[model samples]
Target: MRVGIYLDDQGRSLDVVVEAARDGAKAGFASAWLTQFAGWDALTALAVVGRDAPGIELGTAVVPTYPRHPLVLASQALTVQAAVGNRLTLGIGVSHRVIVEEQFGYSFDRPVDHLREYLSVLGPLLRGESVSHRGATLTAVGAVDAPGTKPPSLLIGALGPAMLRTAGELADGTVTTWTGPATLADHIVPTITRAARAAGRPDPRVVALTFVCVTSDADARRGWVAQRFAMVGQLPSYRAVFDREGVDGPGDTVILGDEASVERQIRRLASAGVTELVALPIGSAQEQATTTDLLVGLNTRAG
Candidate 1:
């Protein structure tokens, strides 16, 4: 399985972000991911980083689908694909109600239907075909200029069964967080693979996102991570996943331990049918660096 690293979005300058991607590539990480939020647009930063780290794959852990229409997103993704020499994996999602409705002032009703409509237009557009798609919720009438760019692989942040089915049927795969190996092997992989087989598509990719920290003080580290990432567990979709995984909260699902323990868990995830393990390292500066160094070593050793 491939290994990827998720970069922190801490208001770093563009040069700093690019330099980080360069460093990640030099360390032999297969891919580097960025998130979309208030700080920096993931795709834009990836575009800038592409010039410096052209050999490494670039992705978004996800960009929200509500604010930007699929046509618009496909346009930007294709542009980034061009910049990155066709090494873009466009991960997108219907973000939480609090962020979509309350924060962005966009309606978050019937997201499954919305995603279905959105992908219908977005997929064709990414293939360089014109779209005149009209659905109950979305209408995309034109295609953007993507003359020389190759189409990017599309992934969805699907947690629930319905979303998983949709991901298998429509997209290349799903990216997950706060989900453990047991839930993935028993539920996620099976459900999505069944849907993909039914749709006559290739086996969908399963990208597992985990917070990694090689430390003895796991309980203490969980406390710190909970302080930073606990709100994610409150999101309805994430809560459902946590419940299904038999976990009390997001902290329980994190991958934290010493070097050997962490490596064993990563192998278990691969055995659980994960195509990629995207590690989001967390902890103090020294711990984070150590975790990253181990991951960089894993990229070479595991390969």
Candidate 2:
């Protein structure tokens, strides 16, 4: 699997995100990703980030698609692409109900329909063509005005079968979080692959995100992770993936163990058809350092 690192970008400045990505690349990570948190916008930050580390792939685990019109997002992504020499993967999603309806005040009704329409507009615009679409939830009548060389690949944060169908049809692949290998092999991989083959699209890229902490104190760290991500199991989309993997919560899917154990589970993710793994290192400072050291070692060994 292509090993990537997830930088902590919540509420941090663009400079910090860029710095962290640079640091990760220097540490021999195959790619580095940023989340769509409250601080710097992921793609926008990557405009400058890739400059700090010339060739590393920089991606957003996702930026919510509801707020930005596809035309607008396409333009922004293209801008980042042109700036960074096309080292961007635009991961977009119809985010959770509370965040969309409550936080952003956007209606979360008919999300699958919304994502379908959203991708229809987004795909054409990314290809440097005009999109004139009018769906139930959104409309776009224009194309992005940007140089679209080396078009960034698009990934949907798809968890359910319907969403996976949409992603396989329209997007380059799916980006997943709190999803384990069994779920990927049994439910996620099959659903998306079937859809992609039916649509005659290229094999879908599966990027799995799992929290990892290389620690001697596995149980204590797992307890911390459970409390930290306690709310994820309640989220409908993530909960579905958890249910598929027979996991009770997000914490259950985390890959927390000693170095050998952690690497072995990571290899299982690859076996289960994960094209890339965006490892979100969790735990205390010491744990983080140990995990980073192991990841760096793996990258070096691969090289």
Candidate 3:
């Protein structure tokens, strides 16, 4: 199984993101992922990381499709891919209504249809082809060729049924967060796998994200984790995943313990069919570094 690190580029500076991504690559991580929040744009940060770490695979765990046009996004992704030598992965999503509607001043109604249309136009545009189509959500005419290689593999951040089906039919894979192996095996994996097979495509890659804090003390670990969970539990979409997994909260899914325990947790995810696992380290800098090192060491497992 491939292991990567997911960096929440919310409050961190661009330099910090680049430094961490460089550290991840130097430590032998397979990839470095950047997730969108309120601050830096995902592609922008990824471009910086791409320039800073030449060999590392850079990705956006998710960039919402509501605000930006698909062609614009595809062009930006292609640019980053060009800079990084085809080591860029694009993960796009229809974000929550609160953020899309309340934050971005966009309509949240019929997001799935919007995404379907976005991908229909996005695919060809990213592949250096002109796309002129009229869809329920997006319409475009002509395309400009960006100075880049072929398009990066497109992954959709999806949890719901319609989104999952769309991901399987159109995208290269699915990127998920706030989901444990139980929920993944029982719900997410089956849904996406079924969609891919039904579409006559090979099994789509399942990339799962989880938080980890490598600490020896139980209370310290639990306390550190509970705080993170408190924030995640407040998100309705994340709450559903926790509920499906029979987890009381984030602590139930977080990998917090000694090295042995954390390693076992990762193995569990692999058994559940997670092809790529992205670990988000939450805690003090030291603890985060420990978790990062542990993940780097696991790259040997791929050998």
Top-TM-score candidate index? 1
For model 1 the TM-score comes to 0.96
The lDDT for every candidate, in the order shown, is 0.89, 0.87, 0.84
lDDT by residue for model 3 (39-64), tens: 89888888878888868788888988
TM-score of each: 0.96, 0.95, 0.94
RMSD of each: 1.3, 1.6, 1.7
> Which residue segments of model 2 deviate by more than 4 Å?
300-303
Better of 1 and 3 by TM-score: 1
lDDT by residue (242-283, candidate 2, tens digit) is 787887887789898888999998888888999888987888
| Model 1, residue 34: C-alpha shift (Å) | 0.7
Badly placed stretches (over 4 Å) of model 1 are none
Off by over 4 Å in 3: 228-231
User: Which is the leading candidate under lDDT?
Assistant: 1
Residue pairs whose backbone atoms clash in candidate 3: none
Show the lowest summed lDDT stretch of 10 residues, model 2. 294-303
The CA lDDT at 232 in model 3 is 74
What RMSD does model 1 have?
A: 1.3
lDDT of 1 by residue, 141-203 (tens): 998888788889999999888999999999999998889899999999999999999999999
